[model samples]
Target: MDGLGFTVDQMAEAERRGRLFGLAGDVLQWSGPPIHTVQSAADELGLSAEEVARVWALLGLTVTGPDVAALSQADVDALATWVALKAVVGQDGAYGLLRVVGTAMARLAEAESTMIRAGMPDIQMTHTHDELATAQAYRAIAEFVPGSGT
Candidate 1:
């Protein structure tokens, strides 16, 4: 057993699964390393940090402090979209819509994760255990489902 009390096989399996998840994140385009802090994003968009945090909270995401570099390009783009939406719908309506969409998307993401996990074959059964092959299989399954991950 390793230091964590996991067997070698368990560790290998965990590593393989982590790689697959990383590949999936890459394919999704929204999992890039964060490059913008809340303050930076607010400065770029000409909004106060509080407003940015509020929008993020409305989208079902945890609101980080202004200095945390937790916002990726996709996040900033989404925030920009929210700003535009708020312009049209006004603050109250925008918040309502964001809350509803965030909840629905969260549910959809959960369903998609379940479906993908179900669809993947057991690594031991395949006897391949190759990262490339596993990643291709994961990508195929992820793309096959028409959900938020796609």
Candidate 2:
């Protein structure tokens, strides 16, 4: 049987990686936690679909169909963070963050995707989420402080 672009060795490596990541078989067939559709997430966050889309779009995300399952837990957290940011920085500052941060992250993801498609090594799972978050917090602070990391 023809295997298209995937050789037996490549398929084996994929299986090994999937097993290591606790993922079963295909991404489509994987039994995993529930992610949210745009509409459902809006309902959960008590926001209008238009509002959610506006914010999510600022982050370079476009959800065309309401039933499209696209959002993860981090996206949910982002919505909550938006609420907190509004309380702290008011409306304009919060939206500004959505535009700046979203664009930056989307660009970063594009770069990462390009490297990965060019066969960069698999992503390392060295830092726990907590450790990564703490490191990111420090890095953001250092970037903000003039001549700190320079």
Clashing pairs in 2: none
lDDT of each: 0.68, 0.58
Quote each prediction's TM-score.
0.62, 0.52
Q: Model 1: clashing residue pairs? A: none
Across residues 81-134, which tens digit of lDDT does each residue of candidate 2 receive? Answer: 797778899889889988998888767657644654354222222433343343
lDDT of 1 by residue, 42-132 (tens): 9987899888888788778874567878888878887788889889989899899989988987887788667666766632225446665
Off by over 4 Å in 2: 1-34, 118-150
Would you give me the overall lDDT of model 2? 0.58
Q: Candidate 1, which segments miss by more than 4 Å at Cα?
A: 1-33, 63-65, 121-150
Tell me the lDDT of model 1 at 33. 55
Model 1 whole-model lDDT (C-alpha atoms): 0.68
